[model samples]
Target: MSGADRIAAGGVTAHENNRPPKIEIHGIERIFLKKNETNGAQESFVALKDVNLKVESGEFVTVVGPSGCGKSTLLFLLSGLASPSRGEILINGDKVTGPALNCGIVLQGYALFPWRSVRKNIEFGLELKSVPKKERKEISDYYINLVDLTGFENHYPYQLSGGMQQRVAIARVLAYDPDVLLMDEPFAAVDAQTRETMQDELLNIWEKTQKTIVLVTHNIEEAIGLADRVAVMSRNPGTIRDVVPVNLPRPRRIGGVRNTPDFQILSHHIWELLQDKGSRGGSGAQSAAVPRVDIGEHIRDDAVI
Candidate 1:
């Protein structure tokens, strides 16, 4: 069986055995008080409501939605950078009370220190944990190689391309050995080809490390390409509209998978879901038949916010 099949089967077995999920978001609702420009009065804006999800250990889940649908807000809550007005987030059966060391986040901007070299950037987290210099070097070396940045260890962020810098950001996160990785549009800044390369690299990393990852993206192809399941969210008081499973065979290549009948069908299905303004509280089928039209044209037309 393919590695992806094993992961899918293992997840099912884990659930049947009543094992607690690796991460759980229960009844999450986040409210933000914003100043109204005209009135200069504070108004409560509901960014997220009734958000709930459970991620099994070693699963890769992607979230896609229109802009302002609280995708990033969900990651913030998961990372404990912010708290929900209602609901609780739990990791390994423990409620998250504050920033968690076991959770590492990567943002769109790369967030690498311009002054720090690749090695230094990857070791920053270990430094915080007071890992010994020798041990830190060992760990950083492993991750630098893992991300295929071994030769650029002494290079600073400015010296590398956007994609390379993003790799450094990922390596830095992985260096900390976080059980869960939360990525917020980590590859959105790179070119399309580079983004595809990064997606394949990430799948390889996930296969080797078995880390549970939840990534937020505005690209539907990206969302479906990298995920074991895609969580489609809705806005205007944001909520998850559907959780769509990607059953394409495991160890997938982004380019190859896009050409498959299943991939096109899945992309069209997700596109239709996003286009439906009134869609709420529905689950996607395991498989569906969709016309062989170019899904990209539709994506470009509506632009999967």
Candidate 2:
């Protein structure tokens, strides 16, 4: 067998010697065909393959993989925006097909509409679903306060800073009260300091809502901090290679958790995995590259995972 093939086959055998399933993904696959307009040689690219992933409800799972690995593609399928070329995805006991109201998605750019004020933007979903205007206002206000964007409610998208915009975006989703939040690197566009703040804010929200969040990110640190489990994906035909459970006790404080032996061990293990993947040009992450997908195409321009 080829080296990659041997590793692929053996790695599963080695890793799955024992472990129970949580969220089962069966033979998921997708292909993107880029047409050569002039030459007319249809170049079909496989974005994902026979992939399997298991995530427990209420589990905060973050996925990291390589360039051209189809990370965003997989996420889109999970979010019900796109369908897999072949395969089935089940969350709890049901299959995902059309955009289900049960799943809320947050993109990196804070995709707030420029035409709407912060409050209106936050209320958009509820309004679309025909929620009573009064209840929509109430829920939007509650989540607006939750995200600490109360003062900015009157402001339009252009008036708010990137971080503030993201806060509003999050609140908008939270207002809808979906069972799962599928975030596509929601914090990637902000400045480093703001990113840190955003991370803390997300944790705070998670504590309150306990929403099952499945986030796609390139930031290992962010993944470590926010996720209950991290699923590392591989190159091309992206698939979960390792599912690391973050057993660290929560009500977590930053910097401090990074010092814990367990945290350090897990981080190191994931770091090593990234390195190995990089060495073989496998994907999880790397030093030279930002280690994420571009946000523009992803609905979150900074998906560096």
- After the best TM-score superposition of candidate 2, give how far the Cα of residue 289 lies from its true spot, in angstroms: 18
- Candidate 2 residue 107 Cα shift, in angstroms, is 1.8
- Give one digit per residue, the lDDT tens place, for model 1 in 174-259: 99989999999998899877988999999999999999999998788889889888888866667788777787778888887887
Question: Per-residue lDDT for 132 in model 1?
Answer: 100
What candidate 1 gets wrong by more than 4 Å, as runs, is: 1-17, 277-305
| Model 1, residue 60: C-alpha shift (Å) | 0.4
Task: Predict model 2's lDDT versus the native.
Answer: 0.73
Q: Whole-model Cα lDDT per candidate?
A: 0.83, 0.73
Clashing pairs in 1: 66-305
For candidate 2, lDDT tens digit of each residue in 35-59? Answer: 8889989898777877777766666
RMSD of 2: 6.9
